[model samples]
Target: MSCSEDPTCQELLDHIYELVDADEDAIDERSRALLAAHAAVCPSCRDAVDAERHVRELLRRCCGESVHAPAALRVRVVSMTTRVRRTE
Candidate 1:
């Protein structure tokens, strides 16, 4: 069951980040369907989606294919930051 009768442009835009990170999370099927349908007819949204996809791809390629840090590295970084304070 979809929350919205049809995904509005605003709704799609708001969730665009989720769409870009689609593989990272299980976005609902209804929302995914709506995004696909809307992008087909909405040039603005299609362009935005394309740009977001491109940026994500580039980042993946440049960052060695994983957007997230490896678990071991993350643990080390977190421990090191325990005493560091953010200045900005």
Candidate 2:
């Protein structure tokens, strides 16, 4: 059954973002372990989790490799952000 119809699957999907995030603080180790245990027993949940990880890896490999923004653009953005206006 799909996650859309399964409560357990839906719960797993709900935490998918935390499951896929690289930041350790995104989810506790206990929670991650619990999800892993569930996914291990559920083929549908396992496939979903794998797909999310694959997509995240693809995005990181493609977009995360971009060079820093040009210095001119950075300067313009900083100038705009630092501009102050009088309230009076």
Best by TM-score: 1
Please identify model 1 stretches exceeding 4 Å from their true place.
1-3, 23-26, 70-88
State the lDDT of candidate 2 residue by residue for 1-88, as single tens digits: 1222224766787677677663365567767777777888999999998999899778778879575679999789746644531221
Per-model TM values vs. the true structure: 0.65, 0.59
lDDT (10s digit) by residue, model 1, range 1-88: 2326577787778677667676334367777777778878999999989998998788888987546878999678756654352331
lDDT of each: 0.72, 0.69
Task: Tell me the alpha-carbon RMSD of every candidate.
Answer: 7.7, 11.2
Which candidate wins on lDDT?
1
| Candidate 1 global TM-score | 0.65
Which consecutive 10 residues in model 1 have the weakest lDDT in total?
A: 79-88
- Estimate the overall C-alpha local distance difference test score of candidate 1: 0.72
